[model samples]
Target: MTIVETTSEVEAVVRDTLAVHQSFFLATSGSAGPWVNGAYFAETGLFTLSLVLEQRGRSLAAIRDNPVVSVIISTGSPTEPFLQAQATARIVEDAEADEVRRVLLAKVPQVEPFLGTPVAAVELRVLSWRATDIPNGWLPGRDLYDTSIPVAREHRG
Candidate 1:
């Protein structure tokens, strides 16, 4: 199989993968060191991911101290691998918290109980991502970021 390398190609894969995955692994670091946690997420537009975190978790604390974070999302298909994204995290302001929570609930209803607890609404701005399709080397892998290639329209319609 041919490898996908163009910016649009990579974006398409990333979009598709994100569409099929509701949860991802979030990695963060703070003065105490590094932490990784699984979180249920919701996506807005093509590049933003939103999630709610307990106000006092290590991951949340790390994000408060440093916004840089990484997220890994899988396509949820046995045939596909995972997508690793490097992103910047930001706490949603009170003005937008309700809307963010609404979106998150729509995607993951199980989070309802946790919502009652004090939590922070966070948004992850994707900076770059990578995916590998190396099933015995049948297809080459691709690693790309926002600056890896010039942004271009994906469709003419």
Candidate 2:
């Protein structure tokens, strides 16, 4: 398989991945340290994910202390050992409490009636993205695998 080399191509694949994978790993770090966490996410836009995070949880607290965070979401296909990545995370949130909550709740219907929920709202803005293909053993190429070629096979007598 050929790796994408253009920004538009990257964006399209990332957008597709974001649509396919609703849950992504959210990693956060504080002034003192860094920690990784997982959660179910909803996309607010092509490159935006809005989720209601526990206000006091390590992930939320860390982001509060240090807004920088990392998120990874792979194509759900069974690519194993070579699944393609969508994008990198740079967590951004709404300053207006209600707005943040609104965006988060909009994506998650179950959050509709949780008015008193103590979770902070956030939108992870993807900063940079990377894409790679699985290594199919045979022909040599960039990695240990060879690139897949396009062709049409015909069956004839």
Candidate 3:
């Protein structure tokens, strides 16, 4: 495995990880307290991911109440790197649903079966990311990247 030490290198690792992972854990909070759900995700842009959610589901309801969320994606291996991030999520508006669907389908075709169902696409813009540096012998250590500050990257995937 390649050792990642710079921001650009870490970005590449993140992109690669997102490209390969099919699902992630999404955590949200609401009047009912906190909740977490597994969902398929597609990398939609720099520090961004998109997933489908039931319009009236707990996760969506939580997101409606609080846009802030935590996400975790792993390779499912103890020695492999994993990713955790803090993000702001929102249900895709009707105006952009089509485009978001297109992007989601391009990455996760298995989701096509549910596209006709009453599902809404939710967009997650990561505020900050913590990526494990396992490849560099940092077993539990993670390198942090903040996206709150503008970076030179395209907004659209």
Candidate 3 off by > 4 Å: 1-5, 144-157
Cα lDDT computed for each candidate against the true fold:
0.78, 0.54, 0.79
- The true-versus-predicted C-alpha distance at residue 154 of model 3, in Å, is 22
**How far is each candidate from the true structure, as Cα RMSD in Å?**
5.3, 11.0, 4.9
Per-residue lDDT over 69-109 for candidate 1, one digit per residue giving the tens place of the 0 to 100 score:
99888655536866877788999978788888999999888
Clashes by residue pair, model 1: none
The lowest-lDDT stretch of 10 consecutive residues in candidate 3 is 148-157
Per-residue alpha-carbon lDDT of model 2 for 75-101, expressed as tens digits?
444352212222334344446556656
Error of 2 at 100 (Å): 4.2
Q: Which ten residues in a row have the lowest lDDT in candidate 1?
A: 148-157
**How would you encode candidate 3's per-residue C-alpha lDDT over 1-157 as one tens digit per residue?**
4434466666766777787898999999987889999998888776788888988789999998999999989967757777888788988878678877888888889989888898888899886666776766655544455536564123312
What's the TM-score of each model vs. the native? 0.80, 0.60, 0.85
Model 1: what TM-score?
A: 0.80
